[model samples]
Target chain A: MSGGRDRGPDRGRRRGHSLHAFRAILAKDLRVELRTLQSVPAMALFGVTTFVLFRYGLDRTKLSGGLAAGVLLATVLFAAILAINRLFVAERDEGGFDAIRLAPVDGTALGGAKAAALIVYLVVLEAITLPVFALFFLDSWAGLAPVAGVLALADVGLAATGVLVSAIAANSRARDLLVPLVLLPLLIPVMIAAANAAEPLLAAQGPAYGGIGKWVGVLALYDMTFIAVGFAVYDFLLED
Target chain B: MKVPSLRALSIATILCLGAGFTLVFFYAPLDADQGFVQKIFYLHVPLAICSLAGFMIAGVHAIRHLRSGDPVHDARSYVSIHLSVIFGVGVLLTGSIWAHASWGRWWVWDEPTLVSFLIVFLLYATYYPLRYAIEDRDRQARYASVFAITAGAFVPLNFLAVRMAQSLVHPRVFATTSGGLPGSMLFTFLVCLAGMALLWTCLVCFELAAKSASAKLSRLRRALEGETYAAPNRSRIAPSVPSRAASPLT
Candidate 1:
């Protein structure tokens, strides 16, 4: 994005630089996150704490099937909501939107970067919290691999939809409240797909991968749909 | 580019709905399984279909609004969603009644269609807060359009996901009701569906026309009574349609 600084009347030619702009924004977001540690640590802590709460709330030290999947995904989803709400705060507060508007770079680069950044946050969050959940609840780690797969697909969908919603809610009053209210309903499909897919894998006896393909397909469809919609509409959202 | 007059639309709505209810009671055969309670199906199914269609139509209008930067399209989009949400209320109420009658429960998470409708309704119900949260008129409309389009796309996917999540224990409602409806039942259902669709359209027209009149009245007040003469109780969240003499709503 900084390379746009010297462009003049030939700025229209810079349209080809969206990928570079996307990378720059992604790098900047990562660098800021690494320095400040605002989102990931909080999300990880929230996820872990949620597991502890669920352990007590459900009164189940050893969960399996749909109950286990529900407990795990619900924690992950709410934590992701925390990350999503914070995704666009820096831009909103520091005049980053004006900077993007003035830059010759494509506006959608911001959305792409934010989503990528969210996916990173979710991955790091899952990495930390999923282990804690397993240690606290599960008797075996055999299903962890496919459970991770479900979580991975769900993270992509969540990130895409989250970033899109974050952009919208970031500009409104009571934005914090708006994000979850508008977003939770939207994320139901993701929850359904992920939970159902993870259930059989999280079964009490052993992990079974049956019927996982279709749910994975649903998650993939959800990711692509939101990513495309977010890309298409981010231009309008940023148009002041 | 003229819309039917509100009175004419209202008449159509009444005629269709009246004929539909009459057909439901007088013509359609009683269900072998669910005798009288099955009648709610005629009302609930049509409302659900119309409400879902209205949401998708709002998405189309939202697309046009974004492309044209026209408040008229935004108005249409808003009214479409707004009226559909009202229809959604009817859907839920009647659906609950049907469920209570059939399953002996007021609600059933096992039923994919009912659950999915609830999800869609909850999502669109947030539209009001989303619009009110944004103080900027132009920004509010634009963001709401973005939301409308996103939620519209979500409707079908939600149904698919929820349906897949349904367990095998609860047989599908249609399957239980029998795979095919008899001729008389199907005819009655078609009339009710048409009636509900017309009612939705009439409501949209009614809302848009009311909004247009309010806009025009405010514009006239501004012109005659000076800029400082602000009307009390003017809604802050409602998108104000530009008062053009030849507006399609008029």
Candidate 2:
């Protein structure tokens, strides 16, 4: 059955709210995650630890330009991968996919829900990590706001890709290893665009908008492509 | 369902390869810029183009596989990617040799084309392990198709991202202007490209034919040997060709 968007008078009366299904699934995930305190806190802790490691590894008191962007975005992306790996675990082990298949709602709801949930985790990730990164390295908070904007765009793409990849790996034997192995290469463009966009913003001189537009455009393109892809292929990936 | 016979394809391949090589070394004029070393372009560029093309072809086949649930399409898709990865190895080696010859380094991050190709290669490289990690044959084919399609879509976008990140800092190694390639060099490059494309197609056919034969042989063995016969390897990653005599699930 087509998702709620295409239902008509002749098509059927039993069709409405793929949106409702998406919301319910997303709410369930968020509630479970909140109650258990599983993913975000660990990801936040990982982010703080990574920033500490970067401080020692780069051996710089303050950071800017490519270095700051690399350290910050890479940390967020890796932490996103952590969340991504576990995204479909409960579904796989607990027959959530069967529930989705049995429901009247469209299968894309699961992917949409998962991507929405992952984006939430990423936003929370940036919230915790950005302040710590600023305290540890940034001389001014001026660049932080723009970096967050670039990161938000990157997160959409990451979430779309992460959901699709997580679904694929979730059924496999080595789900943990397969997630990063398959995901990191896919995330390279995100890294390239996000890091480039953030670089000028993170410049040692202070925030600059110069050339940020191009990278943002790239991030937007990457997000649109993956979202469209995940939406189109979600049904097939969820098939019995 | 029908393919050109192996003899015809091999003959065509040999002829094109021979003529392409001859034209590259003899007929094509020396580059005014890089000179002798530029000849590697005929080899490297074609290999890169064919390899990328093969990947997109695999994606197309994957789309059909997902839609039709045909293991034949999956087999075709698998062989296309398998051959492309092999060709990718050639692309990297030739590209590296060219880089070394021209830039005096085996690897350079500055060249966006090289870097993009490496990223594409790296992404597709995971196809094997992804297939191996899934034990169920049908699920493996299904997931592998998803990977192929996603990675295929990624190729052009990855190039765009890598190119934008570099911002044309790469020394234009090919031609300064869009149509600037001289007629003679263009002719030779076309020949080599055609040859490489033929070689790729020929390899795909060879691999598919080999896989089909082996699948048929196994099916025959099971029929003759009956219940006592065991599959040689239950954990094989490659898709077993679904011949008309055999059910796809088998």
Candidate 3:
């Protein structure tokens, strides 16, 4: 299989550097997402519906402090899971994974590209959902700024883990069920840090800034750790 | 490969456990705070530590499996996580008993270690399902290793996050009670920890031996009766022994 490409000149050319491949894959995913409107819009809609459910579920028109933080975090988390579940469906159904495997480009690029795409979906989901969340529950908007920072860091951690897990689940027999079952437990630390950070920011008194830095540090640590792990293990995962 | 001396290990485990229990009940002084109920701590904490160590050790074996492409390492990793999960159940049960005795409740989120342990247990409990969801054996083993490594790394971070979340409110329950332990209590605790570690090792070896024996029996049956007598296995949750390791006669 490697005979034709064993020549020196063709080797470098065939094994095109990962940056180009990464960008190509990321752009392709974005274009498909844009044209299809498959994941982001549905996730946004889910977020809004969940918020309304929480409104009646909690039986409170207004929410603040830990309750508001918990509801908002949980809503975003479930929405992210929806997008994550769909992240690799196209690649699996269509022959995207096989194509990437055949290519000489590094396999980690697929992980990187998929993670980048998931991050975009999360950002868009937050954009649509956070405003609705604030209007529905928050007494004031003072907390929104710091909470956005926390959410953004949390999004990175979510993207790193979601992309890796989505790839693993996509190839499994019970792909749909396996994604959520395995992913939720892995996400507890992220949820813990995000909720803890957002709790004070969404407080009833007027948005305290205390300890946001520590929680953000934890989020960043989790993000970096999983991103490195996903990159290191991506090659092993790709082997037939 | 030569099998380790399971008999000696079992004897050591029994002796250490017996001595540890004697120290707990007879020699060590009762806690001024928790009184007789504090005895459960010696059991719960050691099991908790051993289980966590077992998980990290599984991650190490998984790394070896991936690097060497050796199914023996995979078998070792699987058995380690299996034993750890069993120990995790013990930790949760004993922990619940301690919580009920002290706080009058079966479960409490305020106890960071117990809560973190519950989360860890929930995470590892999915390992069997994850393994079963993959149809291919080689792929199943590889994916399971990846899961083990990821979950292993998550253990410490999960504990840290949970501890941080609870730090502000919960007054470090374990620390306050065991901070300045008397010399006898400390010695007894150390002995119990050693005993629990030995028990974990003995159980892992015992399970591995049983699996190896079953694999060898199947191999013998295949050799004697040809292909027709060998039936396909229906259950996918149990990790398979590498064929080479299973057949000593070969």
Candidate 4:
């Protein structure tokens, strides 16, 4: 560990090394997830099943433009909800929150770490779902690249919001129901931007990059705002 | 200085709203485009603006509650959101009426403002359930404040994103044919806006007073009878007013 490498300044700065705490939490979550196979696989499987349901429900062999964007975004959003609903369960069950509070580290680290973990889960879910979406509904792959950018920004927004909401719902009585009820409305703007941006790229003729930048900018703004807010208010949520 | 009594504010709200309605019907000229249907605009827009403002005010109160650790701020935040959600119903109903009268549809997704309000209303409607699901009083207040702040920030961004999504395809429907509001319409709109704002304030004050009175009565009952007479009930979704109900304004 780097704890002993710099003994002088590091000793004085130990409490402020929230980054170290954040990394430890993130690593712990990732390790547990890897071993348990808890969230990612379920999200990916849910995404695939939703795509199949869309095929049967919409009664379309293939989809394009706004319809395609809506279907894909909604599917991915539900999958994200599946992941988010479970994000804080381990912490609540195992008394991880008390441990975090007792440690000499910034409380926001838990929020940051949880958000990062959710982002990782989302990325993995997308890796599996995007290909299936293309194979099932997309007429061309040209738009997929730009759509990836939209997805990334949207994922950050989703993770930041999901982690905060999950934390709030964790100690509540109806934890499972409270998460989705509170989370969906908060994610509407992200879904709006992602769907609008993807609509052009997923057009039947070919991908168009014309208006994608504006929507991506909206997504980025939403991400930054929620991340800052989550960071600022998370400590209040943690205080016993 | 003494705060203006709730009775005074309620009377002022009545006068302003009455005068605003008269101006809408008799003073302002009918629009060349939509004629009588456009009248709903006077009611709809003001309600929308007031409701959104109420949500933001709740957010401010939530910030205070979180910072000061005061239950009064939480009560204020809860009441503000409660009133705003009621106003939100007005916005949606009036909006639907306008849509039906203008476009022959009961609901129109093409109107970005209405759609955005719908999204926001749905979001805030969950606030009660969220509060109910939390059993601890203090924790519920804190979490509700967090929700309020987050949802408040979401209001403008949601409007912007929804507007952008619609702008590329649909021309905005609520604008006057003259490209800018004429003097008479603008005056009438301003009056209605003021009236709605006043009504919102009056209702918030009334609710606060009612809640304060209820809390004091409960305290009095406990004082005269005993603790067992006013036993602590099961947790409620509404925020509990602290026993210090002396300052309803806070």
lDDT of 4: 0.88
Give the least accurate 10-residue stretch of model 3 chain A, judged by summed lDDT: A1-10
- Comparing 2 and 3 on TM-score, the stronger one: 2
Q: Which ten residues in a row have the lowest lDDT in candidate 2 chain A?
A: A9-18
Q: Model 1: per-residue lDDT, tens digit, B211-232?
A: 7788888878989999798886
Residue B116 Cα positional deviation in candidate 3, in Å, after optimal superposition: 0.4
lDDT of 4 by residue, A135-162 (tens): 9987788888788778999999999899
For model 2, residues B149-213, the per-residue Cα lDDT tens digits are 99999999999999887756454546566666888988999999999999988878777777777
Sliding window of 10 residues with minimal summed lDDT for model 4 chain A: A7-16
Best by TM-score: 2
Model 4, position A79, has a per-residue lDDT of: 95
lDDT, residue B1, candidate 1: 39
* lDDT agreement of model 3 with the native: 0.86
Evaluated at residue A232, the lDDT of candidate 3 is 72
How much does each candidate deviate from the true structure in C-alpha RMSD?
3.4, 3.2, 3.3, 3.8
* Residue A18 alpha-carbon offset, candidate 4, angstroms: 1.3
Give candidate 3's error at residue B6 in angstroms: 1.2
**Can you write out model 3's per-residue Cα lDDT over B26-51, one digit (the tens) per residue?**
99999898899999988998999999
Task: Arrange candidates by TM-score, descending.
Answer: 2, 1, 3, 4
Off by over 4 Å in 4: A1-15, B1-4, B168-179, B231-235, B242-250
Instruction: Please identify which of the two predictions, 3 or 4, would achieve the higher DockQ against the true structure.
Output: 3
On the 0 to 100 scale, the lDDT of residue A198 in model 2 is 95
lDDT of 1 by residue, A1-240 (tens): 335566663465576577788899999999999999999999998998888888888888899999999999999999999999999999999999999989877789899899999998898998898888889989889999889988999999998889888999999998899999999999999999999899999999999888889999999999889888887788888988
Q: What share of the true interface contacts does candidate 3 keep?
A: 0.80
Q: What DockQ number belongs to candidate 3?
A: 0.84
> What does candidate 2's lDDT look like per residue over A1-240, in tens digits?
666677574244333457788999999999999999899999999999999898899899899999999999999989998899999999988999999988877789889999999999999999999999999999989989888999999999999999999999999999999999999999999999999999999899999998889889999999999998887788888888
